[model samples]
Target: MQNNKSAARQYVCKRRSDKMKITVRVKPNAKKDHIEAEREGEYIAQIKAAPAEGKANNALIKLLAAHFDIARSRIKIISGFSSRNKIIEIIYTRKQ
Candidate 1:
């Protein structure tokens, strides 16, 4: 058994240093709506609201904020507001 502790530590450290931006695919107005986490996972979310009048987009922001335990103001819709796919930018400072 060789020790690879240092290598593992570095990888974990780098991940923490990076602020994660997740891309989600929205499926609106399905039968009994739900959210599913992908295996290659990037915050895949589903909503019951239709993609109209910015309703689904608003719902997405609220759901993500609640799930991540962050303020709604922190998550912004960077792009794809009208499309099914969206990019969300989550900003946070490094933990002390």
Candidate 2:
């Protein structure tokens, strides 16, 4: 029983690690809000909000969540919180 529990924990950890990381180049204060896939694991986001008081970041998160069809909470800014270029992590579980 102990071994089974340990194996289950390991499996959960491994499953949680099955997430995707992407690089995003954000353009704040654009005319429109949109997201374009530059290549695999890279994106260009044009946001309408200005880069002030985390508004642009929040807008970016909303846009990405809509594009990916996931909750905004599932997306995290792993780096570059104060820059245009940011690294984002998306947590998702594979549907089976």
Candidate with top lDDT is: 2
RMSD of each: 9.0, 12.7
At residue 6, candidate 1 shows an lDDT of 30
Off by over 4 Å in 1: 1-18, 31-33, 93-96
How many clashing pairs per prediction, in order? 0, 0
lDDT of 2 by residue, 43-75 (tens): 779999999999999999999999999999999
Error of 2 at 40 (Å): 0.5
Clashes of 1: 0
Could you estimate the TM-score for every candidate? 0.70, 0.80
Clashing pairs in 2: none
